[model samples]
Target: MKDQHEPKTQSEWQTNLEDIGAKEGFYEALGDQHTALFVERGDTLIVTFENLDHVYERGADRMPWGYDFVTSRGWSMLGLMAHDWTWYRDSEVHDFFDRLRDEGFFERFSNVIFYGASMGAYAAAVFSSAAPGATVICISPQATLDREVASWETRYKKAWRRNYHDRYGYAPDLVADASAVHMFYDPRAPLDAMHVALFRGANIRKYRCRFMGHRIASLWLQLGILKPVIEGCVANTMTQAEFYTLLRRRRENGRFQKEMLQMLQKLDRPKMLARYCTAVLARRRGPNFRKALRAAEEQIARTNK
Candidate 1:
């Protein structure tokens, strides 16, 4: 048998949760497919969804997404981890939420926020229905993988086999009663935009992150705007203006600029590429950007000749 200190199994992961300073918490298996790790702290609760493998491989600490960040602020956390990309479509998971609602687990909290990204984002949005007035902050979420509903969604083909037409199926519909839903997605991603279109509602605030791709959360983290943005949303203090201001930091992000340059090159937009590279070079010295600039200049000179 492996040593107790080595967190190689789900049970061990649960054991490690206790070491992370949970004032009052419990880790329960929602089935073989999902696990719930609840850490009680203050009046505010931030429920997060993530892949089980992701949580395990996240870092040396092996905590859930934003676990430390939320806990340090004296907030509670209930993290749902999926064993795979199940889109959290399971009877056990549904019953767990039902039980939480029945017990009024959410009512104890003065404020509750459901947060996640990508596949996890879909789970966060759909499950927020368990706590009707909860605020949902989902990045690059899909409305539903149902064939009839989101037929345009060609991604997550493996998840299409799961029943999305059932309970907690349609994320957009389930999150309708939420007090506020903050959705962040790259408008340039066609499928993601289509998914965003399905989430239309007065309470839904759509933040278009043009070039950030589907992994907006990771990109925002790299840009150093993730913590503040999440804090603002959790505090109900995030405004459209404020969010855009924070997103402005992406202009200086190396990954963002690199991807933008690549996109420009792929589209054969030498003029736009030249202008973009010139702006990027003005501030920072990037070997890739310099090479791209030189190529763009050569293309421009050739075209002019």
Candidate 2:
């Protein structure tokens, strides 16, 4: 039997909560509302919402790439605080957006991108839809208000329901006007892909990355791999195929090579080395039979030392 007292893993926590009564417990724990803003030099905007029961202070460092991207582009940021997932009353979030609109935040900026991971991703998707031409990129987003509320009830039943009812109103109803929606998910995750599929906005893109585990890992991958794609999409610099080619080439070049070499040295395990060598050789050989065997042998010898 599992240790009842031990801290649960994220998956375990989620599962246990679901098995219990997720909806009832969640709505009872709603707390204070707070928001923070970070302004950059350029005319871009990024709004982030925190997860349930999480304070923004705890998660500020979680998205460095997001901060870096906005600052680098001279954009400004708005970070919302939710005592738990249910902190943002629907009126509050909408009013916040209205305030931004009134201040010409979106109108003045050349580009606006709404981004978040997990619960924050849910907020980004729902809110960005309200902006006329904003682009949204969500990593592992929860697709529905009802599901999220139900799932949280195990730990925060009352707060969850209250939040679902009071703040967001409903998840499906929140995403009616998104300009462009892109979602990334791990295929192995236990949750269904309904949320990602239901985003029938004007422009929608969905990608499944099998290697990265669910949660923040996928977000990190997006930083390294999706940056250019996002920039291209926003700036109209390259088509998706062209952008992907560029990103893949960059990964294959010196940076990825150096990183892989360092990892090999650290692990110092033969099986890993062999796997690495095989992958490298296979990538090089393409469809050629003789070249593959020769390349694999060469890689093995090099790594063996």
- Summing lDDT over every window of 10 consecutive residues in candidate 1, give the lowest-scoring window: 52-61
Query: Which tens-of-lDDT digit does each residue in 197-262 have in candidate 1?
Result: 988789999999988888788788788999999999998999999999998998988999988998
Q: lDDT of each model, Cα atoms only?
A: 0.88, 0.54
Counting clashing residue pairs in each candidate, in order, gives 0, 25
For candidate 2, the per-residue lDDT at 212 reads 44
Clashes of 2: 25
* Predicted candidate 2 versus true structure: per-residue lDDT over 1-305, tens digit per residue: 54564334644533443333233211111223534344545676666666642334333233223555655665665555454455355565567666666777677767777777666777777667456677777777766546443453233233454445533455444555556666767655546355565556556766664434455333344346556655665563535566446545533443344455455546655456556656765565423323433555666689779
Best by lDDT: 1
Displacement of residue 104 (Cα, Å) in model 2 is 4.2
Which runs in model 1 stand beyond 4 Å of their true positions? 1-11, 18-23, 56-60
Stretches of candidate 2 off by over 4 Å are 1-31, 38-40, 50-65, 81-91, 102-104, 147-159, 165-168, 171-173, 216-223, 236-305
The estimated TM-scores of all candidates read 0.93, 0.57
lDDT of 2: 0.54
